[model samples]
Every structure is written in structure tokens, then in C-alpha cells.
Target: MQENEVITDRDNVLFEAGIKLGALYHQFTGSPVNLDTVDSLEKGIQESISVQPCVEKISVSINRDMISSKLNGKYGYCELEGRMLDVHITAIFKTAKVDVSLAFDTELDYPLMKIEKIY
Candidate 1:
């Protein structure tokens, strides 16, 4: 019983960290951007996450790739294909660590295309 409680506590910590990272990604990527914006976003997320009690360290990686991809075609509103940025965040918690990756389509007025957990 004691061991199970410990495991649950660790799991909770990881889950909370993941959620915080996801929210940070959404907040930072919800706008149009350039290299400078990306830099600021990374710094902002790291600083914000580091202040969390469970977080010990945080790292953010941004990948810039230009590709043609479908966007919001379901409602007969099609968007032009453009550059897509992949943002990866790694949060090291006191008891665990998590990696969250998200995609942002720069063509759209609002970024933040998708988000997922890497591990």
C-alpha cells in the first residue's frame, strides 16, 4: 500500500508537469512569430515552468520546417499551406521528467496546431 501511494504521487507529479508544459506551449505559440518570438517563447516557458514546485529544470526546442499541409478544410474553409514549427519541451521534475511536443502552423493567424507527449 505504501509503495502504491509513492507510485501514485510520482505519477501525479509527472502529469501535472505535462499539463503545465502543454499550457505554456499554447500560451506562447498562440500568435504569429519569427526567430525573436521563438526565443522569447522558449525563455518564457522555461522560466515559468522552473518556478513550479515540482519542476527542477526545463528545456524547450523549436523546429522550423516549411511544408504543405492541410488546415481546417472540414468546414469548407481551406487555409494555404505554410511553415510549420514543432516545439518540444522537456520538464525535469523533482521525482520524474516528461517531454511534450507540439506543432504550430504559422500560416494561420492563431498558432498551436497540435500537442502530444513524447514520453
Candidate 2:
């Protein structure tokens, strides 16, 4: 195998993991809150990440915190209707390990959650 080929393969693994994480975030945001949402989300996220050819294992954790009051203008001022959540995703690939943290707010007009940040 050539040196460039090895590097390219590694890059591809990272790229694929990143894309899967983005898709997972999109799937979770703005989703309806229900008894089965958590279960479904976990299953979907795991399945999505694990499907990557380079992925070895994946772990997803979601933390939902209730907003006591409506967010004021200082805090990007959105109506407080749905929950705020922090999603942590870890993907272990054959050549790399990727950790993604996403902050989401689901109170906006759209059914999907608003992405606050990605770390």
C-alpha cells in the first residue's frame, strides 16, 4: 500500500464519522418528546454510527434539562416551550476516535431542535 493511500483511508474514516454525527444531530433536534423518543433516538444514533465501515463502537448520551423560564433577549431570546439537551457522541473507528458534543434547543417554531453549538 502507498503512503498517500493510507492517509486517504484515514481521512475518509474521520470524514464519514463526522457526517454521521451531523446526521444524528439533525435527527434528534426538534423531534417530538414522547415516551418512546429516547429509545428511538438511541437506537437510531447507534445504528447510524455503527453502519460506517471504519466504525468499531459508538456511545451516545443525551442530557435533557428543563428551562424554568422563558429565555430573555440576552440568551438568544427564544420561547421556552420544549427541552434543552446536550448530546454527547463518541465514535471509535479503526484508525481514530471522535467525540462530538452538541447543544440543542427545541423551543423554536420548527419541530426540530435548534443547534446551539458543536464541540
Candidate 3:
């Protein structure tokens, strides 16, 4: 593939991955962050990639990554805490330039309220 083509493909992958991660963040957080929010955030990120002047603007490659996630928060009625998930992602791309590595983290917890007085 031509260098430009490769760059395009890699950028697409990165953008998609960012969106996926944003969705996962909402899921893990038990929140309502949707496609609109993801799209908005991603646009800013992409723009930054293009506008920011930098040297050796090539690509990047990642591999053998291990992710360990832990969650701890108050659930109102009771404190809820535990390991939410763990993942290992292997990403590969061109190097020598500004390669944006997007990392996201989220904490999720559900709370139950107790009645103080009977009505």
C-alpha cells in the first residue's frame, strides 16, 4: 500500500478504536455516554492530529499490552468495589511521527437509597 493509503487506514483504525473505548467507558461506568458524545470527542482528537505541527510525523506501532482495571466506589446503601475488567491489545502502525495513543478509564457503581422516615 502507498504511504498515504497506509496512513489513512491507520488513522481510521485509531478513530474507531477511540470510539469503541468511549462506548466501553460508558458501559463500564453504567452511564449514558452515547454515539453523539463519542463523535464530538473524536472530532477534536482528529483535528488535533492534523493541525498540531510536529516533526517525524509518520505513524506508530503497539504490541503486547496488558491492561488491568479496578473499580472502587460508594454504592450509597453500601460501598461496591471490584475489578471491572482486564484486557490486552496489540496495535501496530508506522512510526517516526506523532502517534496519538488514546487511553480511557471509567468507574461504575450503582447505589440503593434507604428510607429515613415512612410517609
Sequence-dependent TM-score of model 1:
0.48
Better of 1 and 2 by lDDT: 1
TM-score of 3: 0.27
Candidate lDDT (C-alpha), each:
0.50, 0.49, 0.29
Output the number of the TM-score-best candidate.
1
Clashing pairs in 2: 29-113, 30-111, 30-112, 30-113
Prediction 1 global C-alpha lDDT: 0.50
Ranking by lDDT: 1, 2, 3
Runs in model 1 with CA error above 4 Å? Answer: 1-7, 66-119
**TM-score rank, highest first?**
1, 2, 3
Model 3: residue 40 alpha-carbon error in angstroms:
31
Candidate 3 C-alpha error for residue 16, in Å: 0.7
Query: C-alpha displacement of 42 in model 2, angstroms?
Result: 2.3
lDDT of 2 at 17: 59
lDDT of model 2 at position 101:
47
TM-score, per-candidate, Cα-based: 0.48, 0.46, 0.27
